[model samples]
Target: MNHSATAMAFRASARRTLTLEQQAIGELIAKLDSSFDSACQELLACRGRIIVTGMGKSGHIARKMAATLASTGSPAFYVHPGEASHGDLGMITGDDVVVALSNSGETQEITGLMPLFKRLGARLISLTGRPGSTLARYSDVHVDVGVSREACPHDLAPTSSTTAALAMGDALALALLESRGFSAEDFALSHPGGTLGKRLLLRVRDLMHGDERLPCVPAGSPLREALLEMTRQGMGFTCVVDERGALVGVYTDGDLRRTLDQRGDFSLLRVDDVMTRGGKTVAPDTLAAEAVRLMEDSRISALAVVEDGKPIGALHMHDLLRSGVI
Candidate 1:
């Protein structure tokens, strides 16, 4: 009961829990069998959405499993077994696959719905500790997510078992993701509001300033005129184009700084005299994230968006920053 004894006891308990959970996850690697494969094949063949259901602690894991499966391209959603017994059973159809999670494999709320799932002709994939239980017996594929013992000192809580189930769910989701050739772009489509989605889906056209907002100066225009355009547009840069409206070069704030460093007669100079020819440029359809990389590599803050040899728009590093591309 002393402070030292109490601290040692707490550390011992924490280590024991972590060790049990680690072993539980490690054991799952050897437990994977043909049943896991069959479960994946069934889920892949399902023409309708995947419906995941469970009860109590298993229900929490089922919701997360559904989310992972859905975000990874499996198209799944969680359904509470207790709710399924109500009007929610309408969510399940003949073409769907039902993934049920039950530590004991005999959760009454779920097993009670097995006949209805069968009647609806939906395939059942069960993750259970006891393969001989009713829920497993009724399943088309039963993946055993058993653990030797709970992390709890009394072995009364669903600790290590839930960890094993979670690991199994992740393994299933990633396997199917690879099997279907799901690309990062596909994942981005489902997560369009996240950083990855913005990086993958946002294009230069979506963020570029075009038309009147695109600052441009004609070749041979006075350097003073180009400076005015850059100030007016506030893009810190201006594109230099020929008489044909084709991009000839770019002039940036950096150029203005260098021009000032020269301390020459600015009134006599033309925009072409100080412009950076063949500057960094990107297509309108190019990803904004890729544009960021180009800017970083070229050590520039702005880029000319060119199409068919003509500058159509401009993009600044500030624009990318505001859009969360940085």
Candidate 2:
């Protein structure tokens, strides 16, 4: 056959595989019943973490399912079924929920542990393509992730079945997450090193320049003095404070440019005269992400950190960038 025929055949095969997998997922969604609800309730009521176990390709899917459950609100971890018989069974307990995945539902390594799970009094939830098989027969609740056809042409590989199982796992996790009212803040607590965690967990106080590094001048100080302070601190702006050390205005490089464009002899101008009065300020407790939004919305690069209306610190866009808060 020509290259064109070969490429066309490959594309056709890919399309068929995707169609089969999509159908499998649709069927799984339709088949979701009280059994799925029982599984979710078991997981929610579990005082200990959910223990997910499987073998072969199902094991890989189980590990991912465990990770998804853990990253969301449900505490879960994966244990290889092959390892369960050799002391790993100690990980299971009465308070935990055990979810065993096996498309065939008769995998010896998995079915062999049913009695042990029962003896431990841990609730058993099975995900399988074979609802009538040994694992499902003994399980407290069985989620049928059955697929009518495999994406593989030979109907041998675990293609469509695995996809259905994974989708089912995701559905359960998100449902549980919403039911628990899990917020982005909760997610950030679990992912403190990721970008989303930085946005949700980092506060202005963590990145702001405190009193020691603050660039500011009394409202009565001359523009020249404020400029000098800005230069000294190298923060591109100077906060103007009142007699009580409360922020009254701000003088930034933009203010200087506007003053210069007016062609005035601003050297003698008071900091208050040249400054933008009643400038936007943020509390020290503000989220760094919130600060970034404020800066972007106001078209400014810096903000005066205030507490009880008193100037306490200062922060700039670069500070956020330096700390990876952006």
Candidate 3:
């Protein structure tokens, strides 16, 4: 009844069930047979999408399988067996493949729909325990998802059977992936809203100071004039450009402090004499992530955005970090 005893009891119960489930899953993997390969071939050869259906626990597994297949380059979706029996069967097409899930291979709600699938000319792939059962008998490819035991202590629930079904679904998805030669870059496009896509798609041109905010002064400008430009632009630095507007050099607050540190001889320093030449700049098309890495490595706050070797704008880490993209 106390906290310690309750925790101990919970852990013991969890460990026992987990061990049984793992053993059952291990047996299923070792027994994967030719039917598995045939099922993969049937799905790969289909011109249309995969239609996955099941009831209850199998339905939950079917939904995950559908998502996995869809994201991994296979066109697939989950259709509830009960829903399909009513009016949802119209979603299936003759070029498609149907993957039906039922632990006993005799779930009436699931098996009942096989006749309609056949009538529509859709190939059937069954993930079930009993190969001789109605659903398996009708399937063009029957994957023996049978398990030796249930994780349920009473051997009544569908725990181990569902695990086998999910693993088989993953196998089918990955098999289709290898056959189609899917790649990570292709995957990133499908997940364009995530961080991976941002790293692959975002560019320097998309985020940089341009035109009026460049903090540029003419070559003959005095250090005092360049300092005023840096103050007005707040880019932590100023650029000195030739008449053609190509980058000549850069000067930051750091340069200003170091110059003033040596007895304030800044009066003799022209923008051309004091500026740091060949400062780091990036093409407008460079990825924002790559720019961040460059800035971090160089220990600098900003970089010039250039086009055809001419500085057009500036960008700082603050801008990238604030976008929640860094």
TM values, all candidates: 0.94, 0.95, 0.86
Ten residues in sequence with the least summed lDDT for candidate 2: 263-272
Over 188-281, each residue of candidate 2 has an lDDT whose tens digit, in order, gives 9999998899999999999999877999888799888999999999888988888888888899999999999984787778887779997889
Name the regions of candidate 3 deviating beyond 4 angstroms: 253-268, 272-274
Candidate 3: residue 25 Cα off by (Å): 4.0
* Clash count, predicted structure 2: 0
How big is the positional error of residue 40 in model 2, measured in Å on the Cα after superposition?
1.1
The whole-model C-alpha lDDT of candidate 1 against the native structure comes to: 0.95
What TM value does model 2 have? 0.95
Q: Highest TM-score: give the candidate number.
A: 2
Q: Put the candidates in TM-score order, highest first.
A: 2, 1, 3
Segments in model 1 whose C-alpha atoms lie over 4 Å from true places: 1-15
Tens digits of lDDT, candidate 3, 1-326:
99999999999989988887788778777878898889889988889999998899999999999999998898899999898878999999999999998888889998788888989999999998888998888899998888888888898988888888888889889988999898876777778888876777778888888889788888889899999999999988887788998888888887887788864767767878777886888889888988999999999999888787678999888888875567
The model with the greatest lDDT is 1
- Candidate 1 residue-pair clash tally: 0
The reply for model 2, stretches above 4 Å from the true place, is: 1-11
Question: For model 2, what is the alpha-carbon lDDT of residue 75?
Answer: 94
